[model samples]
Structures are given as C-alpha cells and as structure tokens.
Target: MVDNIFKTAMRWALIFAAACLLLWVIMPEWKSVCAGLLLGVFASFLNALMLRRRVEIVGQAAGGNRRMGMGLGSRIAMVLLVAMVAYKNPETFNLPATLAASMVMPFFTLVSAFLHHKRH
Candidate 1:
C-alpha cells in the first residue's frame, strides 16, 4: 500500500512539475508562482520518501523503534526552512501557491489509495 501511494504521489508530482514548467514558459510574469510550485512538489516528494524510509525502519526493528523523532524533526525543520525562505522572498516565491502545491502529495496519496482499494 505504501509503495502504491509513493508511486502515485511521484506520478502526480512529475505531472505538476511539468505543468509548472509549461506555465513558466507561457507566462513569464507568473514565473515566481511556477518556481514556488516546483519547490513545493520537491519538498513533498522528499517528505514522502522520508516517511517511507521511516516505515521500513520501524517494520524491521525488533525492539522499540527509536530515531523516529529525529527523522520527523529533521523533516519539519527542512519544511520550515523552505517555507521561511519563500515567505521572506515574496517577490520570488508565491507563498499561497507553494502551500497549495505542498498539499498535493497527501491528497493524491489518499485518492490513489481509495481508488486502489475500490478496484481490489
């Protein structure tokens, strides 16, 4: 299930990234928005990868799972750093669009999972 979700999220991310690039080419004025969207997509991809790795580690552990907090904390810090940079540079980064794009991963994951289960 996790594998399916990861693949789905990645597919959507690539689609959106291509769309952003096209949009950037078509309208130079909205370059910031496109860049922000791409950044968000990248961040979301990293987040998904980290989550998958954490799950695998947990599954492999025999005793109580440790290091989960460190993993989560680092992810949070990385996201916050990206967000802060975007927020600080409104001229280059469209905060609202970035945030909207960041939400795409989980949305696609859930949608794909639901559809997969329905088909099964």
Candidate 2:
C-alpha cells in the first residue's frame, strides 16, 4: 500500500513538471512552478474533499458511517500524482489549447467515472 502510494505520487509529480516545462520552453519559472504546483495540490485537495463529501452522502443514504475517512496518505498521494502527470507532459500543444484541454479532460474523466460507477 505504501509503495503504491509513493509510486503514484512520484509518477504524478513527473507529469506535472513535464506539463509546466512544455508550456513555457524555459521550464516553469520558480514562481510559476510554485503557483502551478499550489494550484495542482489544492485542486487535488478539493477533489478529495468533494469525494469525501460524496462518500459521506452515500453512506448516509445507505444508513452507515457519517464520517468519510479519506486517508492522509491518499490525499498526499493525489497531490503528488497530479504534480507528476503535469511534469510528464509539460509540452503544451498550444497555450490556450492546453488550458482548455486540461480543464475539460478531468471533467470528462469524472463524468466517465460516474457513469461507469452507475453502470457497475
């Protein structure tokens, strides 16, 4: 479990770095990297929070535990994972395009996941 989490985190960090580098040939300036990373981490946190809330609601409907127990390890792992994925494909096809693509992709993923879950 621990190894899986660490691996996932590193993988995401690499992806994040790559994406940042790709966007601006010089690699993300320190400040940009800092800001971008913060955004990524915070996004991960928000995703987790939303997920936790969702789980809590699900449990409640099912008449179970009210507390959603998302582990710290998982949260940290997600942060790292997002960072790595960005680093991996830092190359932006186009500034505006990349921005739009990035924004939509995750939402698409979420919708797909939800649909898949519902089907399951």
Candidate 3:
C-alpha cells in the first residue's frame, strides 16, 4: 500500500517536472521561472524518495527497541541548498517559484493517498 502511494506520487512529480521543462523550452520569456520550478520539483521528488525510505526503515524498526528518525534535517538542508542556489542565480532562476514548487510533492502524495483510499 505504501509502495503504491509512493509510486503514484513519484509518477505525478515526474510528469510535472517534465511539463515544466517543456514549458521552459517552449516559452523563452518564462525560462527562469520554469527552470526554478524544475529545480524545486527535482528536490521535492528526492525528498519524497528519502521520506519513503525513512518510513520503511521506521516500520522495520517498529518491533525493536531502537529509535529511528525521519531525516527531516537532511530534507530541510536540501531545500535550503536549492533556495540558496536560486537566490544566488536570480537571473537564471526565480526564487519564489522555486520555493513554491519545493512544497508541492507532499501535497501530491497526500492527494494520491486520498484518491487511492477512495478508489479502494
């Protein structure tokens, strides 16, 4: 069930990233924004994958006495890195667009899970 949700979310993220790339190529005026969005989507996708792995690890350790973290710090660091890059390269990437896009993956996963639950 978790695997299905992860896969669906990843598929949607990829589709969105591709669309952003296509728009970047098709619309020169919007290139910076599209590129920023692409970068953010990539970061968010990676974060999602990391989160899925962390969830699996936590699940596996549920029966044990050891504690496991979801690696939130690492994810935050990744986003900060992307944001810094966008900020440094303002002409190449739009900072606001990048930040906004970075937030989209979790929502995608939530929506996907909700739809999956409804379908079943």
Candidate 4:
C-alpha cells in the first residue's frame, strides 16, 4: 500500500518536473522561475523518498522496543538548504517559486493517496 502511494507520487513528480523543464526550454523570460521550480521539485522528491524510507523503517521497528522518528529534522534541513540556495542565488532562482514548489510533492502524494483510497 505504501509502495503504491510512493510510486504514484513519484510518477506525478516526474511528470511535473518534465513539464517544468519543457517550460524552461521554451520560455527564456521564465528561466529563473522555472529553474527555481525545478530545484524545489527535486528537493521535494528527495524529501518524499526520505520520508518513505523512514516510514518503512518505522513500520519494521513497530514490534521492537526502540522508538523511531519520521526523520523530520533531516527533511527540514533539506528544505532549508534549498531555500538558502534560492536565496543566495536570486538571479538564478526565484525564491518564492522555489519555496512554493518545494511544497508540491506532499500535495501530490496526498491527492494520490486520497484517490487511491476512494477507488478501493
């Protein structure tokens, strides 16, 4: 079930990334915005992957005595790193677009999961 959701989310993210790349190539004026979006989307994908791995780890440790966290700290760090990069390279990346794009994966995942649930 988790694998299905992860795969669906990743598929959507890849589609979005392709669209962004197409836009970047076709529109020179929107290059910075598209680049920022691409960076954010990439980071979001990585974060999603990390989350999925942590979830699996937690599931495996469910019957154990040790507690496992969802790796929120690492995820937060990744977002911060992306944000800092965008902030430092304003000419290359649009800060707002990058920040906004960074949030897209979770939305995609949520929608995918909801649709899957409804279908089943």
For all candidates, what are the clash counts?
0, 27, 0, 0
Ranking according to TM-score, highest score first: 3, 4, 1, 2
Model 3 worst lDDT run, 10 consecutive residues: 61-70
Q: Which ranges of candidate 2 are over 4 A from the true structure?
A: 1-28, 64-120
* Cα deviation of 77, candidate 2, in Å: 20
Q: RMSD of model 4, in Å? A: 1.5
The residue pairs that clash in candidate 4, if any, are: none
Taking all chains together, each candidate's TM-score versus the true structure is: 0.86, 0.32, 0.93, 0.93
lDDT-best of 2 and 4:
4
What's the CA error at residue 38 for candidate 1, in Å? 0.8
lDDT of each: 0.80, 0.49, 0.90, 0.91
lDDT of 2: 0.49
Query: lDDT value for candidate 4?
Result: 0.91
The prediction achieving the highest TM-score against the true structure is 3
Q: Is candidate 1 or candidate 2 better by lDDT?
A: 1
Local accuracy of candidate 3 as per-residue lDDT tens digits, 1-120: 878987898899999998998998899999999989998998898888888888778888888956667499989988999999999999999999999999889999999999999999
Off by over 4 Å in 1: 62-69
Which candidate leads the pack in lDDT? Answer: 4
- The reply for model 4, stretches above 4 Å from the true place, is 65-70
Candidate order by decreasing lDDT: 4, 3, 1, 2
* RMSD to the hidden true structure, all candidates: 1.9, 10.4, 1.4, 1.5
